[model samples]
Every structure is written in C-alpha cells, then in structure tokens.
Target: MDIMIAAALVMRPDGRTLLVRKAGTRVFQQPGGKIDAGETAEAALCRELAEETGLRVEAGRLRGLGRFRARAANEPGRQVLADLFLLHLPDGMEIVPGAEIAEARWVDPAGAGIPLAPLTGEQILPRWVAGAFAPQQAG
Candidate 1:
C-alpha cells in the first residue's frame, strides 16, 4: 500500500536543511504527515509543519519542490508518495519539537550523519546537493 504524505524541505540561510526524528523512529525525515481527506498538499504541509515542528507557515509561502516516491521509513513493505515543498525559514526562528517529534536538527545536506528516511537520503538529499532547487540565475 502507498501512504500519501506532504513533506517540507526546510532550509536555512547556511544551506543546511532540517530533519526530524519522530518518537520511536530511528530514521530522520522531513517534517510532515499523511494528508487528510479533502486537503490540498500545501494545506497538509502547513498543518504538518505546525503540528510536528511548532512552526506556523502560510501555505502561500511554500514553493513546490516536486513529488517523490520511496519506501516508507517506519512502515515495512509500504510505499510513500510525498508531495514536497521548499520552505525557507527566517533567521533565528526556533523550532520546537511537537506532537510525535522526538528531536530535530540542522545538518549539512552533503554528509548528514544520522540515518535518514529513504525519501530524504536517496532522493531529496542528492537533489539538494546537486543544487537542483537552487534559484535560477537571470542572464
């Protein structure tokens, strides 16, 4: 079965991204959760971010980063279809862990030391390191 989720690629000015470990989970992942029935992806992301990270974000502030499919991090034999977004947080915004989140941290995209969800480790990190989502240069 495929679980539909909305995830955020939360970035800081220093070029590090945020990852969270949910309570009882070993793999760190982008802060998000399953989309509720009738909810848009952006709306689901906004709600998940607030619930998991205590960061209230306006849906309009999120930029579409593309969707990714990977094996579910905590659920064996399950797939995850994630709608990802690029979210740039303002300097010094404190991220408090909420709900199921056990811990959160900022890590360099190139060599994140902790274990990561397949979606994060296999797909998202490589794209980030290659600057696939970097702002376009104007000629």
Candidate 2:
C-alpha cells in the first residue's frame, strides 16, 4: 500500500531548502505528513507545516509542484505518493521545530551533507537542481 502525503519544497532566497528529521529517524525530508481522509492536500500541508515547524502558512501561498512517488524513507517495503508544493519563505522567518520533528536545517539541495529520504534525494533534489521549481515567466 502507498501512503498519501503532502510535502513542501520550502526554499529561501539563499538557494537553500529546509529539511526536517523526525524523531528517531536518521533520514531528513521535507516537513509534511499523511493527508487525512477528506482533507485537501493544501489544508493538510498547511496544518503539518505549522505542527512540525511552527511556521504558519496560508494554503494559497503554496505553489503546486505536482505529485511525486518514491520508496518510503522510514517504512520498508512501501511507497509514498506525495503531493508536493513549493513555499518560498519570507526573510527573517524563524523555524521552531516541534511535534514529531526532532530537528530542522537549511541545506543546499545540490549537495546536502546529511542523509536524506529517498523521495527528497532521488526525486526532489534532482528536480530542484534542474530548475523544475523555477518561477515561470508569464507572457
């Protein structure tokens, strides 16, 4: 069975992204959680981000990056289907990790020094480096 999750590629102007390590987990990934039944992806993401990082974001601010799939990071023999979004954080916004999140860090996606979840390493970072998240020009 696959887990349905809503995740974010939380970016900063410095070109680094925010990654979170859940308590007792060695691999770091985007801050998000399983989408609850009857909950929209944007709603779930907004809630999860606040719970995990104490960063309250409006759902309308999340830019859709589409769905992504990868091997589960903490779960063996399972896959995770993630509805990913891009969030460009405002300057001076502080991240205070709470809930199940053990720690949070800013890392260069191109060469993150720590271990990463399969989804973040294999799917997210490559897309990020390839400029998939670059803002499109209108007109």
Candidate 3:
C-alpha cells in the first residue's frame, strides 16, 4: 500500500534548507510526514510542520509532488505519495525537535552533509536546485 504524505521545502534566510534528524535516530528528512487519512495533502503539510518544527506555514501554492519507494531508515520497502510545497516559516520560532525529531539544522542545499530524505536526495531536491522542475508543474 502507498503511504500518502506531504512535506515542505523550507529554505532559510541564508539559502539553506531545514532538515530534521529523526529522534533517537540519524535519518535526515524534511519536517513533514504522512498525511492522515481524512486530511488533504496541504493540511497535512501544515500540521506536520507545526508538529515537527513548532513552526506554522500557511501552505500556499502547490509546489510539486514526490513519488518514491520508501527504503531504509526504518521505513523500508513502502511506496510513498508526497505533496511538496514551498512554505513560509513563522519568525523566531525555536526548533524544539519534537517526538519524531532528534535535531533540526539548516544547511546548504548544495553542500555536503548528512544524507537527506532517501528519495528526496535522489530525485526532487537535486532537480529543484537545478531548476529542472518549474513552478508551473506544482500541482
């Protein structure tokens, strides 16, 4: 079965993206997670953002979609349906790294660092940074 989800492409003021290390673990990923059964993808993004980062986003235009087969990092071998968005973070919200998150860090999207969300690194993000996926294809 496919796990439906949503996530944010949260870029900081310094051009770095916000990535979270899963709590009690080392897998790095975006703040958002699986969308609840009755929730719209955008609603899920907003909800997950606040839950994971203690920040709220008004989830604007549709940004893109992330499709992949989940692997490793405790979520091995499941298919994922993710809706991605460019979000706005509330100013001054501290990163508390909630239950599912161990640490939150902002890093250069182009630089080397901890591996990002498994499928993201291999698809969306690289293409995102390279301008391969334009805003027109958001929805």
Residue 52 lDDT (model 1): 90
Give per-model TM-scores.
0.95, 0.95, 0.81
Model 1 C-alpha lDDT per residue in residues 33-71, reported as the tens digit of each score: 999999999999999999999999999888888889999
lDDT of 3 by residue, 7-113 (tens): 67776555567888886676677668888888888888878877888876665643545444444344667767667666534455567767678888877777637
Worst 10 residues of 3 by lDDT: 61-70
Return the clash pairs for model 2, or none. none
* lDDT per residue as tens, model 2, 1-139: 9999999999887878999999999999999999999999999999999999999999989989899999999999999999999998867889999999999999998999999999999999888898776672010
Candidate 3, which segments miss by more than 4 Å at Cα? 61-72, 88-93, 134-139
Write down the lDDT of every candidate, Cα atoms only. 0.91, 0.92, 0.68
Error of 2 at 41 (Å): 0.5
